[model samples]
Target chain A: MKNVFRFLYELLIGKPEPPMETPLYRSEIFPDVGGVSLLLITLVLVLVYYYVLNHVMRTARFSHWYHWLGMLLINAGIAFGYAIYYCRLHEVTPDSYVYWFAFANAFYSALFFFLFSLLLKWRSYNAARTPF
Target chain B: MAKLFIFGIGGTGARVLRSFGMLMAAGVDIKADTVIPIIVDPDTQNADLNRTVEMLKSYKRLQGVAGHDSGFFKTDISKLADMDTRGEGRVKDAFTFDFGGINQSFKEFIHFNEMDPDTQALVQLLYTQDNLNSPLTIGFKGSPNVGSVVLNKLINSPELRFFADNFRKGDRIFIISSIFGGTGAAGFPLLIKNLRNPNSGLQNAGEISSAIIGAITVKPYFGLQTENESVIDSNAFITKTRDALAYYKNNLHGVNGLYYIADNPDTPYENRPGGASQRNDAHLVEVLAALSIIDFMDYQDADFGEETLFHEYGLRQDAPSITFEQLYEETLHRIGQQMVKFQLFAKYYKDMIREDAGKNYYKALNLDAAFANDSFHKELRHFLENKQWGYFAWLEELARNKRSFAPFNLSTQDLNLLVQGKPVSRSFFNKGITQDGFVVRLNKEERNLTSEANPNRKFLKMFNHVTEDFYTSKMPGI
Candidate 1:
């Protein structure tokens, strides 16, 4: 069970063998649990987002254009905040900020968040349309 | 479309008509295409009359805007004034005939002072001083002597004439009145007499008089709260009813069908002679009386015979209070299913709508603004929340009575627990109605309904469709 949990954790955060020796970021000040903690936080944040979305969809028209826009903005903000925290944890160099990989992380996180939120909203909409 | 001219006379008449209107709103099948209700009461300010009139107006307005697509509130109810366009156009635009000159004492109404000494002596011999001095504003106050005189004039008025004129051959007439009351007891026999009178000088008097007439004589089912010199007494109800029935047995005419409904006077209402204080609770007996009219309409023309057919209301056992289980199989099939369906519909609107509104079911129907904000929606809510005779109050009273019709637990705080055909305690365990089961059913039912862009129209049609399907599936026998 411990090995399975570790494998699952590693699969979510990427291969554990990879070193933080890239040009954009290097491990120095942050503890070893930094990567796991950040991943856990992201998981918690996603779960909380899903919870709220479920609640709002129960009684509110969350699929309206304005509501979708609002949801997109919130998800983007969360992803960007997490990206900034990830960079700060690894202590990215100021000169490496302009690197392609530097912004790619944030872009990928935002895309994932956007797609996940969209999927949830669509599911609720479908559930609503389906009669008992 | 044949019309059913329902003459609701006095307080009891008004209450029965109120039940009929509610049943119509809930989509009960009344074979008539149009219902023309003409209320006859001298007391214009009577609470039961006013409440019934207001409810009828709401039903009319709601049915008007709801269009023809929805099955609920499908029965067309047009005012007598609206139907007759041939006159000088001096229409009152009201359900009740104008009783303008009846707000005076009986003596004043007859112009006692204008009579000579010998005529006055004759009038004095015919009527006692109390009968002559009695006011006609509140009502006859159980004095058929006064009511008979006052109500006889209405039969010859232009309103009755217009009613007789506009009435087609296939159309029908039904009179609702209480046998123990002054106005109804006096008016029922008088109205029938005028309708059947061969010499009555009115357009199409013969055809009108000979129309297939049905009348419901409501025996005194309730009593007054307290005894007072000026008010009606409970002790007299039995004697009055017996006497009235005997009179009907001897002199009743024209009516081809008659329905008799009454309940034991276990619960007495406040002792108000007439006016606003006469507002009574909705009883199961009144609902049964309304159902009788529907039953009458369901019959074929060939069903009528020369002899008048008589019917009476009954339950499974002579219990004090009645539950849905206590009803007879036929009664359950006729009234139970429809009652529960409408009860579920009302429960969904009154309790579960807010939470369910956020579901995809509403969004798919393009109801993002919430159908609650619509004017028709507001009007319906207002109708159900009416102070005197709202559906909620009606059901609550029915459940609280001796023959309780407590099919749903309306007192629960949880919207999820609101289930039809089951008690509140058993709502959780009931099949086809779990916490989320109704919402799902609503969502599914919306897909099946014919789409209407109007949210109010869609809301009513969807509820009408879903509740019917649900109740029918859940309790097929009912």
Candidate 2:
């Protein structure tokens, strides 16, 4: 019962650990974290990002340019959280190169914004061409 | 171009012609290239006649500014004189013929006092003293005997000759009159008899005499507020109608199509003979009478037999007050949708368009200046609020009356009222449609063309396109 409880707690809140046996865990991207757990967390974050992006697009009309920015900020916030989780799980101190490298992974969130804004722009352009 | 020369015979005739103009404005199919309305009434001061002439002129002005071949005001009605001129202009061209030298007492018209004693004695035997002495400036006042003499000169007039001279091969004639009244009853048969005469002394007498003809004889549908002494009486309407119908059964000729319309006298209008007080509410009978013209045009010439094709308006169910459901499916399909759509368009301009005047749609259509203090806007307002025969008043009266065509769920409270069967429940992304929904739908349906720069034309064309789409969307069968 304790083992089950511990596993669930670790899966949800996550835990610090020594390097795992898998090469993915020992890879340059996230050297001290468990590869499976990191993948699971990233998958969940991508889903959450997609869900929030959909909600904004559905509710907010693309009349103003700022709506696209607002959507980007939401996705960037989620991507930044993924970087912070990697830093915590890998035990990378703030001053190290790996710490900055993992933090730089936050820029990946730009892809989400780029793809999101592109879709939004395309929809708005088509809408402008097409009469109501 | 085939023209439909409509002879609106008297006060009832003038009123029905006014309803026909209103129908034409709403984009009803009149099936004529030009509609030449010749109002035949000896009463120069008759209110209904003057009002109808004024309305026909307004319709002309609106159609003039509206682009060529627009669905709105598709039927072009020119004055009898202007039909000869290409550079036609002005509203005061006058649709009514000048009664001229006939506005005096019937006694003066016949030179009763100067006649020999033997002739005077014969005139006394033929006409009552009051009938002879009564002034004709207002009308014959239910005295068809007096009306017969005054209206007979119409067939020989310069206007009739001009009309006959221009009459083409495929051109047709339709007459409107009331069976119970003086002028209409007397003038209808006289006009027909003269047209059928072998020698009308016009340029195309043979063709004009044998022309395909349609007529609507309106029976008494309302009572007078108070009976006047030398005026019409509602009590005698049935007896007059019976006598007239009996006469028509034997003598009515030269007409290929005939329509009869009457309503139970449930709502009586305020009685007035001349000037502004003579406007009557739009009735179901008159609207159906107007529809008979449409049906007449729809029939091929071969369908008309030697005897006149007689038609009477009927409802799906007999009710004192009718809703959209009580109308025949064919009636609903033909006119119900167009009426509702135009009502919505009119209401949008009347009630809901002020805030929206600054929108892209208004700006694109160039209506911003017109809606802002322009003469065109004033003309539009006059078309809507012209005390007696305006669009808004017509719809309101039709709605309140018995045998209503309650197609729109109109109200003082709800701006969001749906057209009869439109869904009240919201669709996927749309909050249920309000009157604003019509404007939104209009935006979708309006053509993207910018060629016609006249604001009035743009407004008319856009609405004509939009209402068609709006109705078709609402009623799938439409």
Candidate 3:
């Protein structure tokens, strides 16, 4: 065994021969670290969702399910952008941000448009029920 | 016997005159002569202008000024069709008619100010326009050949002749024009012909021994290349303007002393010519040209010699031996010319000092702001900050005065955008501003070259607006 080790060491090229026996495993695997990071992110996202839900319920600002759904969609879009571009990549640039920063309008307009439409519809339905 | 006649040709000209008139009243104390210049302009009907006119009319000295020499030198449009262009008739549209009430109001103003028309010998037209009534909408709509129309009107007025009769021996007359466009170009010849003519353009036609006319004609600033081909490439228009100026110079060459302003072609146009450099230069030239005619407080021209105050309404001299354009390369660093130079400097080197590691805010502040940074936008802002007369002041005034009372759904993001730096947006030109954040924030430059910064005609349009406001309203504190 000692002779075999010495012969293998002789075959080494760049570095001086190792003084100790080599271990097979790396200190940490990238996939494990990545999964743990992803789990923490999901936990935070879930908390944010629940907090927003609780706040919405307390305020009663959105009485309808559609409004809640719309808000969720919009928030989701923002979260997606944050997670992919900002949180994960950690990017900050005036040039990258200044122009073409108009994506937020889509989500906002969609939610607002539906809310306003629902408000109008609700008024009509209430009036019909009361026989004004 | 003295007359102060100020004619505002286009927008910039009129506004400058308003300031000039205000300055004259507050600064130069004219006794036994006209206190207020007779303001001639087409925008007399504007509500703001009427208010200003009423205020001017209320001046007690204004009455005495007119009472001493009170005849309206109304312009005569050879044809009735000329009056209908801007949606009015010549009887109502003409300067004489539009300002007639103010002329009548002089009875009260002059008495209050205690002044008289000593000699109605000189007249100044602040109405600067291209050869026509150039409406600067994107499509170049509503432009009529107002230059010829106005020229004909002035030449045919009987009051002009009556005024010329007032000029006595040793009296002097000065006509100032910047050799840029229509009104000045056309008016120069008309003024020279009548002034020098033995027949009867001046008050006392023979009394005028000498005349001094100055023009601050800005030659083409080379930055014009980036401008829209439709506007800048109109060679026919340019040639007409150029040739008319040339003719005026040749005609007036021998009759008077001359000075001029040349354009600094090196000015940067992040967008194009006529914006940061061109329009600013135009206003500076026009205003400085107006100031050039002001007799200095201590400046007694020995050559004027035993001058009697006389008024000349109708008589104009022929074109002289020198044109303002010919003198452009030499003496007279007219304000407009200097402004062009500064714009050029800022355009080229504004960014250099900003990048220097050792430069501090104090150090940066000491440098000429116009050229301290490479960014034209920053340079423009800097230029305006230093010189109150640049485009920044005018834009602020415009945004302030515009009657934008409509309720808008605005957010911090939106407000930041309106106040924030964006190019001159064609989309937003007169529409105030669009409401979408995406529309504003999405674009890389925020505005397309022609659509945004108005480095070309948009800047000039701002100057023109001031001119219009000048004739129409009282000065708003900026």
DockQ of each: 0.14, 0.04, 0.01
TM-score of each: 0.79, 0.76, 0.32
Ranking according to DockQ, highest score first: 1, 2, 3
User: What RMSD does model 2 have?
Assistant: 9.2
List, in the given order, the native-contact fraction of each candidate. 0.20, 0.00, 0.00
lDDT of 2 by residue, B1-478 (tens): 4888888888888878877888888777767888889888877777677777878888888777663466667678788777766644322357887676465799998899999999999999999888898888878887788888987778767777778878888899999999988889999999899888869777788888778999999998887776565266678889999999999989987789999988888866676654446666667777777787787887877887788888888788887766676778877766766676677677777877775543335544556666667766777778877776677777677778765655566674343354654434456665443545555544433435467666567677777776666566545532
Give the candidate number with the greatest TM-score. 1
- Which regions in candidate 3 have their CA more than 4 angstroms from the true location? A1-132, B1-12, B25-150, B165-172, B201-203, B208-245, B262-283, B295-301, B304-478
Supply the global lDDT for candidate 1: 0.71
Clashing pairs in 2: none
- Looking at model 1, the pairs that clash are A59-B358, A131-B444, A132-B440, B320-B402, B321-B402, B321-B403, B322-B403, B322-B404
lDDT of 3 at B117: 40
The predictions' CA RMSDs to the true structure, in order, are 7.8, 9.2, 25.2
Q: Flag the better candidate by TM-score, 2 or 3.
A: 2
- Writing each residue's lDDT as its tens digit, candidate 1 over B1-478 gives 5899999998889989998998888777788888999999988888889888989998898888776557577788888888867656554778987777577999998899999999999989988787888888888887776799888788667688788778888899999999998899999999999888867887777788778999999997887777656557778889999998999999997689999998888767778888767777777788889988998998888899899989998878776656666678876776666667777777767766776554656666655454545667777777777766677877787777655656566787553344434533334445454436565555555555545776677777777776776666655544
Candidate 3, residue A63: Cα displacement in angstroms equals 63
